[model samples]
Target chain A: MALGEVFLIPTVLQDDETALESLPINIINTVRNCQVIFTENERTTRRHLKKMDRNIVIDNFQWFTIGKIEDSILDTFSQQLQLGKNVAIVSEAGCPGIADPGQFLIAEAQKINAKIHPLVGPSSILLALMASGMNGQNFHFMGYLPVDTTERKNAIRKIESMSINDNCTFIFIETPYRNVPLVKDIISNTKPSTRLCIAANITAASENIRTKSIQDWKKEDLNYLHKQPTIFLLDGGRQYAPKSHY
Target chain B: MALGEVFLIPTVLQDDETALESLPINIINTVRNCQVIFTENERTTRRHLKKMDRNIVIDNFQWFTIGKIEDSILDTFSQQLQLGKNVAIVSEAGCPGIADPGQFLIAEAQKINAKIHPLVGPSSILLALMASGMNGQNFHFMGYLPVDTTERKNAIRKIESMSINDNCTFIFIETPYRNVPLVKDIISNTKPSTRLCIAANITAASENIRTKSIQDWKKEDLNYLHKQPTIFLLDGGRQYAPKSHY
Candidate 1:
């Protein structure tokens, strides 16, 4: 039998109605056609699927909650594929296999020569970079920062230096509650002239994305971003002159 | 007057009916509301906007073809924003400010503190990475490789080494015509076990995305990739065991 195809589906970054607008209409068809689903959070995935289509019978398909890529999970996944069952992997938010545990299943699927389809959707990382006005030609997405203060500060310094030397944009995210501390570390460790972009609550009514130099950012009250999902972008090179009169 | 908002609009990666399905419905409202448009190619942008909504009066908006970021263009862009006239930037394909010159305008927008909105749309780079089954937690997007053969080979080797050392997937694109030669160089310069993914004609009926080891890829003919838009991903570390029987 031919190997079953694997679909990498994307979900909304925010829980609001506007957040769902970011998803493509065709995602509904793909979701309905799948026989098995591997998701980061089963409850949230089921809710999102229902929101996408009211007619979908949630219990008709098999579901697996992805905690860790255990051997038993891979065994079931591979066996399903061999049985010619179309499988889908959904992340809590954004695209699968990106800063999520879905890549392990995708890697296994690739080994078995299963066709993989990645549907388009909202990605906070990609959206942040596009709006940052930084050099998009070369960029690095570092999943998260070190938890320790000193190590994170050192990481910030290294990232700033790399940006300066390579003319590349460095993108990193932090856990919601740690957003403020990370911003503080970024401001203190980097040069005053270096550019930093803070994108919070993306794809939602409260979305705020702004780019400013570290010196300028120091004057603002960033308490608003304390617990909001945020993406930080740093660019130490390619400074622009202040706006000139026409 | 309040600074006008700048919208970064994404266009279809492939010129096909199914490709348009990837775009969000909200984009239509944003496009219709804009008073000015900065696009990579005015002709293609007009055609795309027309396709998005046939009822749109294309000539109502002031159009600017972005050839280069000239001082004159920035002057006009700033003036419009200062006047509180919302403007939009559209690329020939995919998201603006990514592998395109839209960043220059965005940089100016940031300098002046204009609100920038990046709408959700198809992005080949993000899509290719999602399906490559490579490490996406940390990755570097190096826009394009060197055009010179020897330099290109050296570049490929460096990319592979970086992937192995950093455990990061490296993504880069080639001009359609150079796809075959770049693949040849990648296969010849990298280790047999190193994995490479070729994603060509993404989002089109002819879409092809596959990941395989260097040795395995060498046995197949790759001429079909010639003259097709393609994304190449290299992952030299993190090899998985061959699928085990249940």
Candidate 2:
């Protein structure tokens, strides 16, 4: 029997119906076709599934919570594929296998040669980069910084320097509550001429994406980002460089 | 008056109705609201606009072709924004401002403080990374490798070393016709254990995405990639290293 396909479904970044506008219509069909689901958070996934299609019987599918992708879960996942049971993987928010633990299961599926389809949806990283007006051709997604203050500062400096040297944009995220601290560290550590983009509440009614040099950013009141879901982008290349040096 | 909002519209990777399934339903509304359009290719954008909504009168909106974001285009874009006329920017394919010249115009819009809304759509780079099952938390998009044979080989080696050292996934693209040649270079230059993903014709009926070690890739026939839009990803990190070694 042919191995069952794996579908990577992306969830809304915000918990509002309006946030669902970022997802394509076909995702509903794919989700309906899957008999098994591996989700980051079962509760949120259930709610999201219900939002996608109210008629979907949540209890009819076998659900697996993806915490660490342990050996037992892999075994069960592989077994389901062997039995030709289509499976879907959903993240807590945004696209799976990106800045999330879903990649482990995806890697396993690739090893088993299962067909994997990644559906389009809201991705803060991608959305931020597209609106930043920075170098998108060459960019790096660094996920998050260290929780330790000192280590995080070091990371910011390192990424800023890397961006300047490579003419590449560096993207990173921080805990919603720590957004202000992260921005502070960024402002204090980076050069005055370095360009920074703060994209907050993407896809929501309060969405704001602004790019400015570090010196210019110092004049703004950033208290609005205190607890907002935000993605920060740093571009250290010379101002208005037609193309990236690399 | 408030500065005009700029919409970053993403087009289908493949020119098929099925490919349109990846786009969100709301994009049609945003496209309709815009009174001015700056597109990479006018003919294709006209066809795409008609496809999005048959009732859309193409000549109703003022269209500007974006070859290079020169002074003339920037002047027109800024003038329209100053007039509070909403504008949309469309790429030839995929998301604008990504691996495309749309960023230049976006950068100009940023300077003018225009609200930029980046709509969700098909992006080969993101889709490839998600399906590749590589280290998505930390990945670098290098755009394209050097076209020169010797420089391209050197650049591949450099990126391979960078990936190994940083445990970061490196993504790059090539002209469709040169896909095989770039793969050949990657195979010959990288270590046998390096993981590579070849994603072609993404979001289309003939889509193919596969990930394998360099050694395993050597055994497959890759001639099918000729003239097929493709993205290549390389991860030199040790096999299945749980998290990227930043």
What is model 2's DockQ versus the real complex? 0.60
Query: In candidate 1, what are the lDDT values of residues A1-246, reduced to their tens digit?
Result: 988899999999999998998888889899888999999999999999999998999998899987766777878888999999999999999999898878878888888889899999999999999999998999999899899999999999999999999999999999999998899999999999999999999999888889999999999999999899999999998754434311
Candidate 1 lDDT over residue span B1-246, tens digit each: 788999999999999998898888889899888999999899999998899899999999999987766788889999999999999999999999887878888988988989899999998999999998898889999999999999999999999999999888999999999999899999999999999999998888778889999999999999999899999999998764434311
Q: What TM-score does structure 2 among the candidates reach?
A: 0.97
User: Chain A TM-score, candidate 1?
Assistant: 0.96
Which residue pairs collide in model 1, if any? none
Q: Where's the lowest-lDDT run of ten residues in candidate 2 chain B?
A: B237-246
| lDDT per model vs. reference | 0.90, 0.90
Candidate 2 on A1-246: residue-level lDDT in tens?
999999999999997766888889999899999999999899999988898899989999999988875777778888999999999999999999898888988989998899999898889999999999999989999888999999998999999998999899999998899998889999999999999999999999889999999999999999899999999999998655443422
Which sections of candidate 1 miss by over 4 Å? A240-246, B240-246
Score residue A123 of candidate 2 by CA lDDT.
91
